[model samples]
Target: MSMGKKILIIGPSWVGDMVMAQSLFILLKQQDPDNQIDVLAPAWSRPLLARMPQVRQAVDMPVGHGSLMWSARRQIGRALKAEGYDQAILLPNSFKSALIPLFAGIPVRTGWKGEFRYGLVNDIRLLDEARYPLMVQRFDALAYPAGAPLPEKLPVPDLHAEAARVPQLRAQFGLDGTQKILALCPGAEFGPAKRWPERHYAAVAAHKLAQGWQVWLLGSEKDRAVAENIIAALPQAQRQRCHNLAGVTKLEDAIDLLSVCDAVVSNDSGLMHISAALNRPLVVVYGSTSPGFTPPLNEQVAILSIPVDCGPCFQRECPLGHMKCLNDLLPEQVISALEKLVPGHEQAVL
Candidate 1:
């Protein structure tokens, strides 16, 4: 087996997808301890790649999100070609996403077959969605030989930022040192389709606080109002233990705070993936999206999704004008998941 091979991976634009792909990085590292894995991704994903030690370098694909993808691909391909990558794996399923490596003239271009980039990609593997139902399974297929055994189900990548960075951030945020941290991520990028009811989140947060857990709500500014609503529902005494960290921490800081949490309760969002990557015990709520496609990778993680007849639609918005999947999830169900994660919290065993 050759060592020091340069592999350039075209990463997924979404944060959660990136987290799911981390297992591929782990496999590549295991094959050759000295392997050089570089990533070409959108500017926002750079912070995430920074935390992964397997990546030798991350080249930002300098382009806006909308159309105009070709122009950006050419630019990224030119930059990657200069670095002399031996092989390239395209993670995102778009013809435009493969353009960079084609233009760069990388020797082996590998990816799934959906993109119809015949000339651009050399080693296109035919993907049978039925055989490989999960997103991680599809991602792993890209790296292996035609029918090689899948890499041992490795734990999701656990890459921490500098040790000093997390502590400084904890102090900056005024997080309680003595209390067990319970990270709450109440927002979903897939609109309101996958979001659990705010009242259930509040109830669960209040319940955890009564047991001496500190609730740190996590989300972007778009989620601040929802976080605020949950905070308001908590009792005044328990509310003091609930710190709204929304709109404050950057993506990197969010990872740091998540690292410290004893467990995280989150909607099916990028934050949930991040917590799973950190190996933190996670309770993920599901609604519109099916766990079959994008479940958390850790065995320690618990996923709760009410299987409604209209579910697995994968729609951004509820199509039936009702979101019963999330609205109907009880606070007690969430509390039960958390109790199993929390040490010394005894509950009736199933």
Candidate 2:
């Protein structure tokens, strides 16, 4: 609403972070119902933004991740200058991410201090990691005055799926809308350290498949091989019910399809956050990463992790060459978590 402050948000590059950013958007709206929020992020993230009703629009940031394309950012900034944004909240702490708002000459630029973004972000806050242990807390903190205490209950990310298109997508993917479905997100784009073993995933898939639940593997194109491996481990009958939607469905399509899933078991991946936002029952297996930082924010979710001394290493690939954390977090833990999220013993048509 032009009646309130026209705020421009420099959104995060990763899908999970972008989804979590919705909490900040919600807080901004709660603070001022008429606050207009527009996000500048990667083109791929537009689909995620579309589902967050709080966002007025999605502004494409043409620069690729890690690229300091000053000319490109300046061009986009010059174009947005006409919009007259009152404030800019940056989810990313990078110095380059603060450039556009500065270029646009937005009066008040807000973000945490990083890469020595001293003058570029006029309203920067020095982060206190001890105070804000959670990543979501850090994002939410930017909405308030620096050093202000956050609300006791921070809003979780909630994405509105295109429910009307569910049937069409189901038909497109040969999914029966009434069938009991279990969705699995087996890939962690961060790297192998965050991923649970494929065989462990297969073990869980077998548990659900035996209980007459169909399994749908969801991830980006990079995850196709792992999805195939999960499917391969199942018997012919169970394999028929296990569908590899990885690398096939678009991100939005995955969001819509996940809406119909009875439950979801996933690594700490983007799709895991999506499923949580959709309010689907979820069990997230943690490895190199820990839930203490970015736990899935949903009532119907379970956070699973077997803490190894080596982890939460937070590394992309395990430096020790042994991912004891993920490898040891057995399938039974996930299945047990699934049981708590959803009482899944009910009979389903095979």
Candidate 3:
């Protein structure tokens, strides 16, 4: 643990996966404070990676999204060779994900066996899913030496990256600095299957605005239409106070803004993870995905999921046609959940 090892990490391509991967980065720092950790990741995740302080640099893999093989492994191998990395941690399960380090001849490469990559991965570990209490715990175990016990759980993510533009963003957006701000991330990257009803979010925002808090809509370009729908549902007075930041600002800008919020309401998405990482008070709505595996870890966070027969369908879209799991969750219920954190937060303004 004391050795200053040069470690190269092949990062997860998805934003949420990238954020979740921060725990591993944090553990590496805790285990070896001086180790130089660099990440080989897809370009899209670069925005989020910039915020993590643990990573020295995020090497972009110039390849398409699908099962892209040639560029990723080749680029990563050349980079690892040039950087003289001694070990690598592959976060993704694909054989292509492991190809880089193995090709680079890094002495130790670790990952779960997938795509029959036995020889490609030297230190492959069997993920006894039952042994670890949580998904994060299971992922964290991969970073430790073989047979090492799980350490006491910690909440903070290792991404030492910061939101450099938050302060300016606050001024530009005309956000009331002193008043409590509530971030509403209504869209889920996974798909409509995981997203709570738009009405539910609108109601939550309306409830908070009535309580004297300012509502800030958070999401990407794809989520802007949803944000607008929610904004449109609010009363003119409430709408005036609500800000639609979707697609306007960068990813770090949203995180910086999220860090400043008194609380956040989101679906099971990357922003939820960011809110948890920042230790912001949060109410995360879960639908197709169960919270049992990767629920919010921060003390200030809470999960709002209604269990149903088709609870963990785990599909991109609802197979049953009736998205009862999400639609059935009333706005009042989410408002009630938020009220606990921001007291009188619902009744104050109205």
Candidate 4:
């Protein structure tokens, strides 16, 4: 095992991508328990990184996505020079993502061949599409020598949630401990193409509510309206039982609260990956995107997707205007998956 190495991991921009990156982190840790791994990502990701025990520190990426702030990259990169990172692994294949490590003058910089980044990344890899089908597979493969066979089972992301924070968050959100919690992550930051119909989520919420469960909607502030709509669709009695925690809880708060959920039903979004990492009983509804690439890394998940000729187009919004893939999928399918998964999880409820 490579011992006492210091590494810098340039994390991905999206939450799901970042979560999936944990597999590589776990792999690196397994290689050398004493290795110190630090992540460079957006400031918002600090909370998420804190839950990852494998990460030693979270360095906030000052620049936003899309725009390449060379000065900003140079500043952060030069600052990291003193840390003396032995190896810098760039997760995102973008040309800009390679700058910081290069500016830092790290000796061993590695990443997939992207945007013809030659000198920016020294140990560049040539990706054989068939060999590394999943994004997680691609990420984990970087931890080994060029032609090394990956382990039979790559480590899955298991986040560490503070046990004591669960109750406080429950109380903060007015969550009833008596009822089984069903968390609905109805928003997909990628776009509407990946989101399951909000009405469909409401249907699952209603069903679980009928079974004496308290439904909680979780997502960013952008998802507030959808959460409210889901609640509005519920009957008056059930509406009172459901809570729209979306737009209210901070990312860390969401992490702690989600850890205690009896079941989670989410779109193919970051929360889906987070739920899987938390090892929650999850039923993820897929639309434009298929699980073939970035499926939730958990055995406790039930992935629901319907194949349509037009999709998985992987577009931000559907070009055909008809969301038959997700529309046809229906809530009954997700609820049924939940019914099966929840009972098994308790043995370890929806």
Best model per TM-score: 2
Which model is ahead, 3 or 4, in terms of lDDT? Answer: 4
Summarize candidate 2's per-residue lDDT along 91-156 as a digit string, tens digits. 898989999999999999999998979999999899999999999999999999999999999999
- Overall lDDT per candidate, in order of appearance: 0.84, 0.91, 0.81, 0.91
Model 3 regions lying over 4 Å from their true place: 158-164, 344-347
**What TM-score does structure 3 among the candidates reach?**
0.93
TM-score of each: 0.94, 0.97, 0.93, 0.96
Give the candidates in order of lDDT, highest first. 2, 4, 1, 3
| lDDT (10s digit) by residue, model 3, range 238-340 | 8988999999978778878888788899999988888887788889888899887877777777688787998789999999999988998787777777778
Error of 1 at 86 (Å): 0.7
Of candidate 4, the 10-residue stretch with the lowest lDDT total is 341-350
lDDT of 1 by residue, 223-279 (tens): 999999999998887887899999899998898888888889999999999988888
Residue clash pairs of candidate 4: 342-349, 345-348
RMSD of every prediction:
3.0, 1.5, 2.1, 2.5
Q: Please give the TM-score that candidate 2 achieves against the real structure.
A: 0.97
